[model samples]
Target: MRYSWLALICIAQLSFAQKKQITLEDIWVKNTFRPKVVPGFNAMSDGKVYTQIDKEGDRQVLRVYDLKTGKQERTVFDNGEHTLEGKQLSLDDYSFSKDEKKILIRNEGQPVYRRSALYRSYVYDMSTGKVLQIDTAKVLHATFSPDGSKVAFVSANNLYYKDLKTGETVAVTTDGVVNKVINGNCDWVYEEEFEFTRAFDWSPDSRYLAFYRFDESQVPQYILPMYTGLYPYNYVYKYPKAGEPNSVVQIKVYDVKDARTVTANVGTETDQYIPRIKWTKDASKLCIFRLNRLQNNLDLLLADATSGNSSVIYNEQNPYYIDIDDNLAFLPDNRSLVLHSERSGYNHLYRWDWKSKRLTALTGGNYDVEQIVGIDEKRNLVFYTAAEKTPVERKLYSVNFEGKNRRTLTPEEGTHGITPIEGFNYFLDRHSTLTMPSVYTLRDNKGKVVRTLEDNAALKGKMWEYDLGNISLRQLEVGDNKTLNAWVITPPNFNDQKKYPVLMFQYSGPGSQEVGDRFPVRDFFWHQMLAEKGYIIVCADGTGTGFRGQEFKKKTYLQLGKYESDDQIAVATYLGTLPYVDKSRIGIWGWSYGGFMSSTCLFKGNDVFKMAIAVAPVSNWRYYDNIYTERYMRTPQENEKGYDENAPEKMADRLKGKFLLVHGTADDNVHFQNAVMLTDALIKANKEFDGEYYPNRHHGITGGNARFHLYKKMTDFVLTNL
Candidate 1:
């Protein structure tokens, strides 16, 4: 009996010893920690069916499924059955027209920037099995007209239309020239900062099209050299730095029936920004969002399509800056509009009567509303997601338009992303927590689960092979009696008597949050790998981050990195007081804006952080774009001291510990000039630091093996320096 018990004990010991530890290769090269997710879905207009792309053997096919039964209804488009240009059609993406009679199939797209792409588009008729290519040249932002009788797209910075009935193409504007004039699309800075690429809107009646015309001849040019061969090639484009000249913008309305264009009289100031141009429900009226250079005042103007005259319907002023969002929902009545406003100190919904020009609050609380999921005008209900439970979590809620009968739809914990169908009858809720991966389920409007779509059982089972440390969501008190949201990942098999080195990661940008209640993304997996190496990874959302309140987020207004860096220093100091922390071995690292923060922390707070790794960081605010920089810090001309005081380039001499700077030479968003200038400053200060540059890589530093190589380098740096 004793021999039998010993045999069972030996078997258990062998099983425990076989479990593996996370490695850098497991994260970057092997991709063993990747999770399965659902593909993009398009809810049909019927409010009962949805469409998604699927792979069938060696071909891609579009399949429609019923929402109620969660079963496939039909195969809409089969690449094996269709042919384009004498070859079998292989669709990369597709979109349906309003009438659902035609599908726009996209293939072989070339990316221009992060959000802009040019693609070869083919219009496939559903009624007849016929496919027609719109243009021989690649086009940007291609879409069918509201009536599905024509297609509009941007080619070579100009707007062009093709009449499906006549098979003829017409140019709406002929003045589009590279770097001099741009029509139907936004400029580089606007596209990068304003978060949109398509700059044209089609009226609901299909008789008028509204677009933007930008004159960028006066803007300065920035060039990036590409070394593909022995000879270097220069790619030059117009880029406006802080306190520099912006493009002269003009809004124009084109009438399809008359072939006439009228310039909108937005305001007398030609230098003002026209961030958004949308068509109202009424075909004759167009809505425009105008902001001053300072971005403190915002005006909503209604313009006539024919007359080209505009009147301000709504005006708002913020002490600091106003934010633009996708919350301007117009009801079917055409008399009222729902606006997302921060007037209540938190982002909430407000109803505006166009005739009376009066606003009424719809949702009011201490927390902030994250998004407007759907609006059921027939039922007079507004469904939304809000951070009511905690700043790190988002929950779904439903309320009346009049701010009555508010009800929480999601009751359980975690971050809930709700996607409602057309009629608000059903929705898809995706929930994820720190310990659990995403689980997708179909639920009714009242939050009753009907069926499970994806449970990620494979990923959850595979995760048991590796050691996942304890991840805790906690708060750290900082200056001004405020608490910052933080997530800490401890090493598995932690010993209370032993001290461990710490590594901090943060993206302390405006209206951004990193410490959220979602499942482990790529960053979390990276942190887990570090934790397995006996390092505690700390991620904190400091001041100036979003999802709190307006005051908490905008406290770092004119002084961009001043308070944020101070909070990081404070966090490091507080962590030093813990029993299991190595105070002298604390390090920090980040990318982009977080990179900027790391450089600043290593310089100004050199006593707190022993090392820092900055990737694609902005050394000075003056080197950044006008819209994003000027919004927070005003122009360098106006706030010269604020721009210079917190700049890492100005404080390079204060570095005391190890530092590593990394950048991509072809990064257009935050130019490589930032790294060059910082290097020059460091050399002048007699500072010794490490540097790495990726050739022909963009801001993301991702291509074939580039990303994997970069992360491996970072892992080595952390291992040695810290």
Candidate 2:
């Protein structure tokens, strides 16, 4: 019996020796854990077909496939087969016209901002098989007309359109300049905060073009230094900080036939914001969303495209602030609209009748609806995804227009993301859990699986060869009858009696969540490597996070970082009581808003955390932009104490932990001035800390070896300090 037991132990030891250990090179440089995704998957106008971009030889080929059979039907365009000006065409992206008779192909795209880009555009005729370049120079937001007769685009802050037959380009605005007047394109602040790039829309009937004109001559300029060559050059652009002057915006309608422009009446206040301008089914009517400076009130206006006259159709007011999203959709009847609102303390869909001015609920519950999938007008069904199961998981559900017969379409646990086809007959669902990789599948409108797409099978198989740990979700009760959602990742061979150092991660921003059930694509493998080093990783979604309720998300209002830091401290206090945790060796780290949270936690919870690392943090709210900063917190002029009391720079004297501050010098989003201000305060307080700066890097700090080097530096810091 003893000999048999020794043989079994020898076999177990041999099996354990075959398991592989994860390295930083495999996670960052080798691309070992990357998952396969459907590239450029776009649904066709027909509900039965879809188009995807694939590589044939060295060129890209756009091919159409049958949804039901999962077979290739035809090839629409092949860059190797087509030529423009004696050169083979290259395709980055393509969009179909309303009739699908023509396509607008984009190539050689150059990014201008976070959401905006300039591209060399061309038009391809399906009948003639001819390719014509729209312009010799690159253009922005090039769009096709409904009738496929013309194309509109923005160039050098001006709006222009070209007639396909005559090939004549006409300018709609003549006063466009480089840094002053912008036409048919969003300004920097609007593109970043409002989350939109093209600030223009075409009428459904192709009669009028509605666009925005921004006069930013009065706004202040921020200069970013480029450290290259012998002499450094400064790139200057208008940036409106908190309590600074904003651009004067105006909405204009252009008549293509008459070549005239009329400004819409958006009130006399130039400080307000026009977040969105959409065209209704009625070509003569345009819908606009107007928000106040404080963002507490939102008004929906319907404007006449010809006369530029407008009237308020709907209005909503919130005590804290309102969030703008692309959730408003008008029905084909043109008399009703569907949108999401938080009036009931949770985000839910509501249908509003334009003529009758009556509102009715379409979906209601304690859970918040994440997004509106599609509206099946023929079947009178509205499909959406919500947190009905739990705050950390998202499931797909469908309900009638009258808020009856609610059915759960995705019954399995985890997060399910849906993308519906044109006619609402089919959808593409990409689902994943905390432990499982993503699985992409095609489904019918009734939630019947049609076919399996990419399932990340190769990546899943590769993960089994490595020594990974278990990630579990739990609720940590922090005080006041409140509990925070948290996830803990323990070491591979965890023991109940051995003590391990803990590293806490969180973003802790308002309406943000770090403790979700979805697969952690960003830093999952890195956390696993840390776990292999005998450390426990914990992430908690604190009081200011989203999906719980409006009240919970807004609890940090007027005091941005107070409650969030307090909750982290409370969580640390609770984790200290665990038998496996070493209370004296706890550390925290985050990036961007998370970086701000980490800095705040290190200073405010000086007795709890022993070390911290902050990357690209916002040290002061006054250094940020106006639209995002003033939403949660009023202007610094109005709320002086609110902006100063919780600032990390103001609390520099309280730092007792091993601190590491990192930032990219050319980050346009959160300027490097934030780091400079915080460093000044730390130096004046006689505090010793470590710092690193990447020259000419943007907010993401990723290009070539930059990201890998960053992780290496951070890994060494954590190992040495924590």
Candidate 3:
């Protein structure tokens, strides 16, 4: 019996030793922990099929698949079979015309900004099976007209359109000079803040093309130096900082047939912003969203495409700045539109009858609506996702136009990202919980699962081979009856009797949530690796985070970092009281806005955090863009206290922790100047800190081995400092 017991113990030890240990290479370099994702597909207009790009051996093929059967129905375009200028074409992205007779194919795309890209484009005709090159050079926003008779694109900041029948190209604007006038494209600030790149839209009848012209000559320019050769070259671009001058924007309508352009009446104020311009169902009328410099008031104007006349159809004002989104959709009635607003203290949907100027709420609750998925006009229902169950989870719901017959389409407990098909008969639900990998499913409109798509079964099986720790959700009560939503990842083989060092991570940006019940891919695996090394990981969504309510999200208004940092400090203080946490070894880290928070928490809560790592942080808001900064803190001239009080650079003297600052030199959004200024302040204050800068890298700090190196450095810093 003793000999048998010894053998059993040896077998158990062997089994335990077989488990794999996760490394930084597996997470970043090899992408070993990456989950399988559903391929991007566009639902066909027929609603019976969808088209997706698939790889066939070494060739790229655009194939149509049956929506119900998930079987390939037909091949629309095969790059291997087709050649452009005797060279094989590579597919990047594509879109079909309104009639589905022609396709606009984008190949060899070059990214310009976060949301903008230039592509070598081609128009493929289904009937003729021939490809026509839209432009010899890479073009921006190549789009097909509704009638499939013409294609419009932007090249070198100028807008031009080509007639498919006549094969003739016409320039709509000739005075489009780079860095001076940009035709049919958004300026830097508008594209970054408003979240759109294509500044032109085709009318329903394809008779008019409304485009935005930005004269950015007066806007201040920022120079980014590239150190590639012996003599570095400076790349200068218009970047309007807080209190700086903005581009003079004008909305113009182009008569495609007449070849005449007329400027719309958007008021005489050049300081105001035309954030959005969309054509209503009535091609003659265009919808324009105009906001003042402060962005507190939003006016929806309906402009006549012919006469260049306009009238304000809807106007909304808020004490705080209003957030603009792609939620305003015109109904087929031509007189009604659906839009989201925070007028009821929570983001919800409202149907506005512009003809009568009457507004009716379509959705209302204590929880916030995350997005308006789509409207099923045939069924008179609006599909939307909301945080009704909890702020951490998103579930899809559908309601009628009159706010009746409300039903939950996604009743699951986790996050259900709904992508509705064109006819609203079916939707693709990408569902996942904190503990489970995402499972993509095809569901009918009634919420019945038609079929299970990719479920990341391989990842689930692989996860069992690793010693991933337990992740638990918690609500930590700070002061004043306020509680923060947080997630705690305990180390593998955790013991309640033993104390463990804690590392807190947060991105406390306004309307941002770090703690959620959804499956995280990159950082989640990294955190697991840390947990394997016996470090407990914690992340909290504090005040100013979204989905709680308007009051909670907007609580940090006018003081961007003050209340958010306070909440983090409070949460850290609460964690310190726990018996399992080592109060003396607590550390914090974050990126971007979260970086700002981590730096502030280290300085303001100097007694709580022993170390901090801030990556691509904004040290001061005044150096940031005007639209985003002024919306929250106002201009530095108007609210200097708000801009300077919580700035990390201003509080460099209070740093008492082991701080590591990392930034990319070519970060256009945040700018490398923020890091230089903060470093100067730290030096002036006689503060000791570690810093790393990546040459020519953007805000993401990625490309080649940069991300892997970044993680390695951060890992070493945390291991050494904490």
TM-score of each: 0.98, 0.98, 0.98
Query: Which residue pairs in model 3 clash with each other?
Result: none
Candidate 1 Cα errors over 4 Å, as ranges: 1-13
User: Cα deviation in Å at residue 114, candidate 1?
Assistant: 1.2
- Estimate, for each residue in 1-722, the C-alpha lDDT of model 3 and write its tens digit: 99999999999888777888899999887888789987867898877799888998989889898888899899998889888778878878889999999989898889888899999999989899899999899999999999999999999999999999989989999999989999999888898999999999999999999999999999999999987899989988999999999999999999998989999999988999999999998889999999999999999999999989999999999999899998888999989999999999999999999889889999888989999899998999999999998999999999998889999988989899989898999999999998999999999999999888799999998888998999988998886789889999999889999999999999989898888889982299888999999999999898899999889999898899999999889888888999999999999999999899999999999999999999999999989999999998888998999999999999999999999999999999999999999999999999999999999999999888999999999999999998
- Give the better candidate number (1 or 2) by lDDT: 2
Q: List where candidate 3 sits over 4 angstroms from the true fold.
A: 1-14
Best by lDDT: 3
Clashes in predicted model 3: 0
Question: What C-alpha lDDT values do all the predictions have?
Answer: 0.90, 0.91, 0.92
Candidate 1 lDDT for residue 71? 90
Candidate 1 TM-score to native? 0.98
**230-284, model 1: which lDDT tens digit per residue?**
9989999999999999999999999999999999889889778998988887889
